[model samples]
Target: MTNRIERLNELDSYGVLNHKQDEELNDLAKIASLALNVPIAQITFVHDEFTFVKANIDVVSTESIPGRVKRRESFCHHSIKNPKETMIVNDASKDSRFINNPFVNSDPHIRFYAGKPLTTPAGNPLGTICVIDNKPRNLSLGEKQLLDILSKKIMAYLNNKRKLLNQENKIIDDALRLQNLTDRLPVGIFQLDKSNQNNLRFKFLNKTMKEMCPSVNTNKSSESIEILFSSIYPDDKNRFINHLNESFDNLSFSNIQFRIKKGNNCAWFAMKGNVERRTDGSKTFYASIRNIDNQIEYEKTLEQIAFDISHVLRRPVSSLSGLVNLVDTKEKLNKKELLEYIGLVKTVSTEMESYTRKLNDIYQKKKEIITNHNKSYT
Candidate 1:
């Protein structure tokens, strides 16, 4: 809804009403004072509940303290009400509006008042830059135009303040969003300065990076790198470091798979990285690390199953084929030969059944282990 509080936020962004900055607007106040031939000048902001004075030139204050007045006591209240036009009370004693006003009857003893509203681009009036006099006097048309020009200058200064404030806030907002996004990512991400092998250090690291390598310290680059490598499984540590060193020396892409100790257990991981070379001949590496424990387990299981089929069942199947050929060649067989053939057939069938059962038993055991391991991750 259209309301005074709605405009308060945008007006507060200029930072004028928070405190008195008499020096900031004193020059403008001086111009208004000298041009209008008045002893008093001020830049004030009129809100719904109070009138806040940004700057004052003379001893007269809207309140007992400087820079504040209740809405009921502020003459600038009328100025904001009629934003499109200037309010001029040439003789406050004669004007019905100010005849009983506190500023006119009591302190500051208002006699003449002239104010131009500081209007926003959206046509909302924030307050006024005004000149006041203790003695009565009217303004010429040229003098009125002069007051209008001074008001424009005041508005221009406040508008510039608002723009800069908004820009600074926008920059802070963008930075926060980027930080949160990197933190929530699943894979660990890091940036390293590869300018010198001896000076290799992490320049940037995401939240996941710390989670992966618990001892990592971004501030101590060499020590953090050493800590991370120490967690690698003994068998794969050398291969991973060799690839990384080669990539750093040639400024080339690197990819490697390794395992790291996770307590008494180990987990598999793959790392991929590429280098960016600056025009100054300095190199940097952008890297990512991903967990590959499940994938590694699956591939190993498949290889075991293939080995069982190739090696375990091969001898039994060959023996069955030879037995069939031998029986066909013995057309006129004796009783002993017939019995021998039957016994051999019985032995072969038993061997085949036993081997098949062994393969099934091994597969079921592997499947159970995989299922339980996967549950822990979930």
Candidate 2:
């Protein structure tokens, strides 16, 4: 639970204190002044140091008088002191608190005051809407009830205004957070509207996405999906589009491996995304694109090594095994045949050695590619 001062600070957070006078608030004060036939009706906001007038209406005109007085002299301050209830002084001259008060003893010569405490939904008293009279008087029960109801309306307006301000701030914060998260990620994130296949539009492209394909224009709606496809190699672009459409139609996940044209160079990328069906029967896709040139190259190198082992080395190894079996079966082979078998085995062993050198060369190249790629990204 917050005390009076703490509650005042929370009220201040809404920025309503000492603000430009509102005509609407002034009109409410006018209505109160007219109904009660009082000289002055005010909507006041109380702070630790002062009671500030938000709306002040006289019986003749509903014009606001904006100023502040010390908290001790403020009638609204006493209203807020009592929680959840209006404070009334039929004759301030007879009250002990106001007996020696400057406002009561001097200018304005306050003699009568009746105030309903304005409160937040959490029951924190903000200030009051009260009427003041120069002559000692009392408010009818009907007039007091009207003031109470008017005070509640004023609080409702303040609460609604605060909600709108908070909502606007939350939207701004969310955008900044989204940008921060995407900017730090290594992979590019994107969103594309496929609602109209003929006019596939780029809905969003984060910082990484912009950097990944510098050639593609990032302007939303204006930049078509063709601009993105243009960055991709011609041979792979069609296949990529086809696979994406298939995924969209099936409402399944999309995975695409393709080559992107980067100026004079080409890079391999792996892209994955999912299509979201809109309530209007339209669809959008959110995706990530990662530069996988190094990964793809390394995989290709491994495949080549496997191919050499199974095809090139396997043939020679098989021939050597057959020759060895023939030699073992023949108990007494001729010297010429034995020498020929030994020569054949040497040839087969040299071929296998060549395959090993090829594999080693591929591995060294793959390692250099990986190291250089990492440095480029970093």
Candidate 3:
């Protein structure tokens, strides 16, 4: 009636099918049974093919009511057809619409029925709270009003359940979306808990963390700093630990570069993070680690080149200047003296050639490293 697909979608957004019954809904059904003085009272949700009994109370016999049944067997189906008002049948045996109904003709043998539709906030009927009796009788105006009021109470309970569930689902969805975004990044995002100063642990680790540290256990709350230092080069281990300790004590930001060794291969990583303090005096460190092996190697090579230009190249150039000055002072140079100067110049030129070759090799290695790293990403 309410555009079947749209109605079902709205129902699904509430997420209330097949879940365990709440005590509040059960108590409402009990109250309905007592107030109406009926042997059977139920809170039902009518779907396309079935009627889901959210709550039920039967006092006539020891027989238990089912959680669900075919819509054809449920009077709640007829109740929802008129979403605006209640549906009452004083004598089901005489009503042509339900005279041949299986529920009336055989089991349960309902002769009196009163059902109030449970409508949604948008005025779409979800189901009903109906009372059934075995004997034919008329309902007083007060009785009908009481049933209507109870139906509204049931709807209120359902609406609250839906709101709480929606909030929980939103939280889970947001967390998953954040994780997906971080997974695409090349850097390793992490949060560290140093509250227990003696036992450091990682509260969170993105995908890149596992890829970067294959041997480290990500699931356990092991000593993260200890594991980290063990994987780092021996020469850098102490400085790295000290830097971390200093940051924790001062609640300051840290930016440090260090080398990590996995198996025999080593790579450089640059870590940058800031400490976040809590009202309870605890702290968390959020950080990102980026692979910087190529950058560091390039810088080291450039430093070496600078040293060569300043010290190594200067030695030979200075020797050549001295030789040129001697030639300028002499009016005529003898063959033997010219030969000695020529030999000295040859030795200096060879040294300069060696320095140029070293510079070329460093540049070539840096180019290869960059090209390979880029290709790996593609």
lDDT of each: 0.81, 0.82, 0.82
For candidate 1, the per-residue lDDT at 287 reads 92
Q: If scored against the real structure, what TM-score would every candidate get?
A: 0.70, 0.69, 0.82
**Candidate 2, residue 178: CA error in Å?**
5.0
Candidate 3 residue-wise lDDT, 136-173, digit = tens: 98788998899889988888988998899989999999
**What would the per-residue lDDT of candidate 2 be over residues 240-332, giving only the tens digit for each residue?**
989987987887899889988877888888999998889977788899999987787778878877887788677878988899888899989
**Which residue ranges in model 3 land beyond 4 Å of their true spot?**
96-109, 195-199, 216-242, 327-358, 373-378
TM-score, candidate number 3: 0.82
TM-score of 1: 0.70
lDDT of 1 by residue, 1-378 (tens): 226766787577676767646575779988888878887888889876899888777755454325788877788988788888889988988988788887888768889999889888877788898988888988889988998898888888888878897898899999778767877887888887755444667777777776666667645534446767888888988998888889978888888898887788888888999988878677888999877777888899899888988898888788889989998897888999999988998998999899999988987888888888766644
Query: Which number leads on TM-score?
Result: 3
lDDT of 2 at 163: 88
Number of clashing pairs per prediction, in order: 0, 0, 0
